[model samples]
Target: MIHEDSPHRSATPGWLAVRLPVHALWLSLAVLAWFAIAAFAPRFGLLDWRAGLGFMVMTAGPLLLGLAVLVAALALALSLRSRPRGPWWKAALALAIPVIIGASLLQLRATAARVPPIHDVATDVVDPPQFSASTMALRDAAGANPLSPYNVPLGQLPAWQGRVEGAQAIQTHADLIGQHYGRLQPIPTGGRDPAQVYDAIVAAMADIGLRDIRRDPDAGIVEGVARTLAFGFRDDVVVRVRDGRIDLRSASRVGVSDLGYNAARLERLSRAIERRLATP
Candidate 1:
């Protein structure tokens, strides 16, 4: 039963180890750890969500990739050894799950790196419509990131500044932002008068699930906060009806990089208003 020179004895156990996920357990555990920290960590409120997500993106993300590589190597060897068996292909595919998920997370970071690291995006960058005082008050309140719509000089925020390139104090001027995201171009009234457009703006905000909706008739400013569905991150939105143009601004209440969410919000609202305004 024991011959030191026997190839079958040595090869069979090694093949079983690789083909059965003995080394691949590292990949599974790392993937599970990332999922727990990135997703459920916010729900538990164990730490600031930015910290939690950042750790997942910046730290665990790389670790996951490393683990995936190891799994891939071991799994590849096992698949070669097991190919003659009936279902060896399944083991190889199973080992690839972690690699695919880890690659996706890294891809997100790569895409974000190519763009400027700024959260505030407005349709009208130059003289972007300011948030109403009431909306500012809500944003400054607890559970929201305290930010000045105009005076939030970049580089001043320690957490946010750390995410930007070169780590210098960034200038928040509209021109700087316009260099990247030019004015979204005011949604034309499309023959609708100021009153109709203003109402449509408010309706669009509500339709998009904004909370605590308020409007100032004289100022023609509609103010509300849009909360993300899953984690409830709030973003302040201000729509101004002036000069026959509907100018909009959407800024996240927390986190330095919004991942283009604020821009997407403004775009979504503009499209919704266009449809509603066209409806008689």
Candidate 2:
């Protein structure tokens, strides 16, 4: 009597069988790779026109190739169904292609997600508090006398308290400019209004064909090219003129270097003030 043998079952492994339907892995990986490129490309110079284009090609090419290989492997596995005796490793290898691709893509995306964006407001057009030619002239002339109304000695003022005074004389001056000139009020005590002063200084410096002026308003210091090789910081120049003498005050967070720059700028500002003060 002839015996009939049982039909052969497909010998694919359980792990591969479970992983076969995970097409999302490849897609995820691809997304990750794109993000990685985006995040780090700038730092590595890969985002440069020529380099970025090349990087894009390289990244996409390998992913597409892997996908193609995956598709081919899957197709081959399916085609081998008829033979039933084909190698088991072939099926596992075919499935792994897409999984590897997905993992790579995910890695790239993770890298991209780690980068932070850059922010800059320096060159933006900011409306600064304005000062009237007459008022500024008066203040400058008063500041010049060393015994005038605006001059105050640092010794008589309170010690540096580190907080920006909102109602100090310097702040009051800034407030006056805003009220009279329609510009935003800057912090009075700190070097809050350096940008405003910067514009004026730049224009003044430009008149003499000097271009490399640097101003640090936070420190109340302004330096670089002007009529002369001028360098001044805050804290060195602000003097309250009183009783025919110069009174230096530690009203704000102005430092010694800052004062030096302020002194220089104040001298120029004083000249402008004098011109206006002499008028009528």
For each candidate in the order shown, give its overall lDDT on alpha carbons. Answer: 0.68, 0.35
Cα misplacement distance, residue 5 of candidate 2 (Å): 4.8
lDDT of 1: 0.68
lDDT string, candidate 1, 256-280, tens digits:
6677778778888888888889878
Backbone clashes per model, in order? 0, 34
- Estimate TM-scores for all models: 0.76, 0.23
Best by lDDT: 1
Name the regions of candidate 2 deviating beyond 4 angstroms. 1-59, 62-66, 69-73, 79-83, 117-280
lDDT of 2: 0.35
Alpha-carbon RMSD of each model: 4.5, 21.1
